[model samples]
Target: MLRRGMILVFSVLLLLSGSMTVFAAGKTGEGATPSGIPLAGLEAFVDNYVKEYIGQKTVGASVVMVKDGQVVLSKGYGFADVEQQIPVSPDTVMEWGSISKLAVWTSVIQLAEQGKLDLNQDIRSYLPPDFLTRLKYSEPVTMLNLMNHNAGFEEYMFDMAYQSPEEVQSLEAGLRLAQPAQIFRPGEVVAYSNYGNSLAAYIVELISGQPYHDYVQEHIFEPLGMQDSIAYSVVEDRPELLEHKAKGYFFEEEGSFTQGSWNYMSMYPNGGNNGTAEDLAKFAMAFMPAAGEQSPLFEKPETLENMLARSYSTAEGMPGIAHGFWEYPGTLRTLGHGGNTIAFATNLQIVPEDRFAVIIMTNQAGESNIVHGLTKEIVGMRELTETVDLPDTSEVQGEFMAARRPGYGFMKLFPYLTLMKLKPQGENQLQVSLAGMTGSYQQVEPYLYQKVGGDSALDVWPMLYAKMGDGKVEAISVYTSDYLPLPAGRTMPVLIINAVLAVLAVAYFIISPFVLLVQAVLKKRRASRHSVSGAGSRRLVTCLSLTGTGIVANNLILALRMLSNNERAYSEVYPQLVINYVLTGLAVLFVAALLISWTSKRSALTVRDKRAAILPIVMIAVLAGLLVFWQFYS
Candidate 1:
């Protein structure tokens, strides 16, 4: 059945791609091609492209461009729900993936500015003993290391922990696993570490003695008047507050929309947060303080300057890390982070020096790259003093449904499968009662779904459904959950295997150094037995050298894997998926390197040569087994 579904998904993808090509070809002549473009021409070009090209595309998106502290253009494009023909709006709330990192960083910096926290202080000083146990080095890891990504922690560890319950027994359990060896000394070169950010959040929570979400809301969000924004998992049960929440979509294939899961996890500070594009604009504006008064949230010039300063370089040879944001080198000096989950992708770029910024939120996955391109284009065009009218969406009509069924066949099964009871209360209004929860939804026209109930069980009820014809309705989409914790009663074998692998990895790191030292001593003793120029002695030396190099390489790889795995354990608490992929890729690379070294030693060799080869080979095999176990059977 899964295979059939896979085939069906692939077929739909091909159709969508083919259709997009045809559509793009048909609209090729809708705008003028300007040669030797001026700012006016650029503005005209961008407006036409967004409205005629991107706006007509299937997915929903919001774009806001600011220049010199003023909003030059802010518009919504496409349908929040295509089946209901709902047009996107600037007020639509979106799950802005990793962009949430900036929010976390902002809150932390606020504490630092208040002299309540210190960037140079060791994180272990703030965290509990259990959390401290997971760290690798004897020396302290400072807040600066965490912010600059110089802590040498694995990016995948945090992601995995956020997604898999068994991988991370608790927040404390995940932290305990972080105590591996450091990849590099603190304040060396920068490496992107989601785990580092997550740990930073944990440190903030420890120091403030507040829940991570509460600290950010009280200090940063509320002060900025970003009332619409909330930590992602906190608002799940309150559909009313989420009435304007935009539906998130994932591509069955490239450029095709399909329902995707909502990411609900406890790691809200790291990357699990949601807000409206308008609110995001306000947040960006705060970065550019007005002439007379200071920002209510951050009143100091030095505070703002420190936040925007480039702290580290990224692998791309660009200025990578700022205090709580990313910096790109150029006259513009943009700072931002792009976020993605299964369903949504978002970006918030700020040019503090020019007092310009762009906030882009898209319901569609895989659309962030395109949105970033469009944002850059719009920013360049803002120099022009031209107006571009938004497209109208008054003609779209109909009820939004959740699914399509084969006529009577679905009605027969509906009673058995339907988890929520829904009834139509008035024109374009629905009263939904589910799991002892009741809420109302009113169709606001052109595909927007709004909750209008005066009294409801949910604090925020943002349910939008699209009628898919033939008596089936699809629920409106929202944020995707990172990894739903398994039911308490269910046993997770995969977690057990991961724990075992983690133990073995620890054992290898602990024992490999001692083994290498003993081998070195033995080699010195053997050197005295024969002339160093003999062919036999030369072969022995060659074998020993290769073996030593392989061992060192294997141990280095294991150490990295261990640290990354620890990060994955915590990442299960967040909603980012990129970290998981990175972790998997690194695990594969580690194993491959070990295998290559092992294969190179299979030829005829002396006892000393074999011993050198055997240790690394054994370590590699154990690590491979562990990874396989964790990936599949675990």
Candidate 2:
């Protein structure tokens, strides 16, 4: 099934890359070329592109462009509420998603400027004692660390948001509910963390003696005169704003739009802003160096500059993120952040050098393609400066796992882990497979690859690899159109061997019992000359049958629950914990049964059978160890 999915995705990528090239060639006349187009010309070009993009992709979108620290255009495309036939306008309220992080960071800068907080001070200082889970590492997480996404907290997945107002908790309560395990040491790697930002916001709340939502509303939104905007700590609490807000939708079966429920984040500081494009433009404009006294942002020019500087990088040569904005490495210095929910996608870009910024918000899922296209048309994307030729392809062929593992605790062992398999295609070329998606990339420079063809063809960003002291590649980073760049760690062969052994052990349990039963019944004797059909054999078979049946039943129940309840299924504690305990008990019994069968003379096994048993025994032991490793059995 996975192989077929990969093939279909790869085919689509080829079609897209081919179509894009053909579409570019089809263009003619003065507007044919996007490059060197003046700002005046860009407005018309963008207007047409956005209209076509909206017709093709979304129910509606709100776009705002700022040039020279002034709003040049703020307009909406398509219908805000399709059922009501209401056309969207610049004033239409839209969910800004993670773009809300901008305001949160701005608040941090404001506090720092006031000398009310120190950027380098331990964040735990601002919170109540034991606010965060303590790890072995003693290095304190600082404001600087959180802003740069190096605070090292694992992604927290549960209780992140609620579907209804009643389910929503206060910021303090929410933080406690979603408290993440700090797995990495401070400043170790730039794992983009939403929890880290929310923690920072909680710190803001602690120091200012103001609720996170209230502080941002009082300082950032109100000061900017964004009358149409409201920052909500809990999205459901704003039932009054529903009349002005666009309904979120997703492309469903047959490319039809399906309305999705609005989810309210308890930590609204991270991604809970609902506002108009014009209002967000005002917020974006505040970051411009040209704003001077006119800027609504309380941070000084020097402070804003500091906010835009590259704060932390996982690798030396890789383009690192700024305090809040992610760095889009190119010939031009572009800092921006893109955001998504189940039913909405949005992007905001700031080219400080050009004194320009663009915010594109859409009421549709997976519609970031529109945001990327329109932004590039307005502000031409420059080529990444190629530095060196590709080295030997053999050096890069291996497996890698995402550095930011899925946050579901023991769920990391799930097959859904986005592992990367890189196979050399030829000189300077490679085939990359991840999460059932396959693509081919050509090395553009020493360690950078341009995704020339694949389902990920839209990922125009060059892939980067960093090497260790041994001259072997340590990790590789890949970026999708809207996702933060993900660095995947290298893995050795031993892990693969263990995984294979575990699968074989499970397979043996599944089929061997039936085979032995048929042999014993037909021959009216033991299956082998040295084997016995006595108490020891019966005990071993019983243990194997129980373990195999339990695993199947647990997974089937989980699959059914997901199919029926969807999001509601995730709201509860992980169901896998119950299964993990059962598996552990069954594994213990299986090992004990094997030991009894081995020692009993009546169940004496042939050398070949004993050798076969060793694999399954080792596999069971490995499973037991993993249960402990992931804290499922403990």
Candidate 3:
């Protein structure tokens, strides 16, 4: 009860602080206008962009643009169902993915307005008493924390969403299974979390005394007149709606397209709405007041105002998270969210000051840049106004790990696994190599850099470096309007050497059995002069062969299982763990045998042979150590 009272006070502080921040950020006139590019010629530019994308064989896409509470453009490009040759249109239904989080967030605001929910109260107050048993931090997880994406839940991977409705579990069941232990104290650093959003929606369900689906239908969709939209918990539950849904596709290696499987959401509110571009644009309109008319969807204008305000941000002013929206921090001051599921990508962006909004939906996954490009064209986002001066970055050269504070035992090896190289370009600029792509950044402040090249709106994109007490660079967090901090790990050198050696060892192991067989055939056919070897050496050779083969086989099985049935494969973690231990034991045995052969008097090996055996022994030992570090044998 005391905790509840404290939270209520905290909630009031957030409101007061939010209003101050908005005032400080200033009103419409204070911010920069849309890029100087004329809005008149933007339609043709977008049409040409979509045509080029279609020429590249993009499966399908729907785009809607609105300005001043009026629909400016609404159209689709390419085939919705390639095999059936169905053309997509503005009304084509597509899974909105994480963009659906907006509905969940808006519903929360509705309840808050009605005094049915408290943003500051402990989430446990709304959940079943025994629902969440693991708590790693002393601080309570509040609704505001969830909204800010600072709830401290570890990244959830297993059984997140499914391909079929039959495979999905109830929301309570999925939460119970996927619920992660708290890693940081609530309201710590930001880490985007789907589980956090789902939990918030579940809280909405409890307070409103209605199922989550029904509540959103009656309150949001119906009120917005979005007849084509449905926030479904299970994908296959609505077959009639499914008929209008655009089939999602993926590009293949042969330059062909393969239809992706349907995604049945387990965490419904995280990314589960399916709708048309026109319908979503309607919902986006409700967020802005039209001609002195307040939103029918929101109870009060103040609530809408607060929802659109900057709720949480880092010190350097990178818009971190705003209520349910992911701020596209730029000169335009846009509020939006990008969503990606199994095969579809969706983006909804709104520039409230201009009363302009856009929703882009695609049948292909990972096309966020396409939507961003469209927005940039429409707004004519400007280039950097002023280039901030920088300090010397001579000492800041090295590899940086994409920092993730793993809360679960299985994720202990996370820090040592991610890698990024910061190569010094000049005195004030550096190039970042991440996942085979290079991004050039110019130092703006003492420790921050803004990415160069691309739309001018992204000039505000910040890459901040945190230093240790002794003044050495400690960790680097890049702001893409979303915070991702990657700290330097000490294991890079060791991991690099180990990775090279392991690759060589696995390659030799795979080819050795076949090579031996071919050699035996050659010896028999050619009538070899020298016999093979002594009994003890031959036995040792056989043992090493079997162990290497087993290692290769185990990896193949796990990979195949993951591709066939991901959820089932996840449940096989214990089995994989057991296999790892068994393999480690086998590695130790092979090493012992090699030692015994090289040292014992009974061994009949030559000096060169003994030295040759050391390579495999070293290889196995390195692998064994890696397994131990990874807790693979635990």
Give candidate 2's TM-score.
0.77
Residue pairs clashing, model 3: 403-486
Task: List model 2 lDDT by residue over 372-422, tens digit each.
Answer: 666665555456455555587667777665545444454455423456777
| TM-score list, all predictions | 0.53, 0.77, 0.82
In the range 481-597, model 3's lDDT, one tens digit per residue, is 122333234356767775786677677667767876885677678753334544455456656765766765675575566555443314656687678668767767876877887
Q: In terms of TM-score, which candidate is strongest?
A: 3
Model 1 lDDT per residue over 384-469, tens place: 12223411222122222112111121121221222344556665556655445666755444333344553332312222323223
Residue 184 in candidate 1, Cα distance off native in Å? 3.9
Clashes of each: 56, 0, 1
lDDT for residue 511 in candidate 1, whole number 0-100? 64
Those runs of model 3 whose alpha carbons end farther than 4 Å from true positions after fitting are 1-33, 36-40, 253-255, 380-383, 393-397, 404-418, 443-448, 454-475, 480-490, 515-537, 556-569, 572-575, 585-618
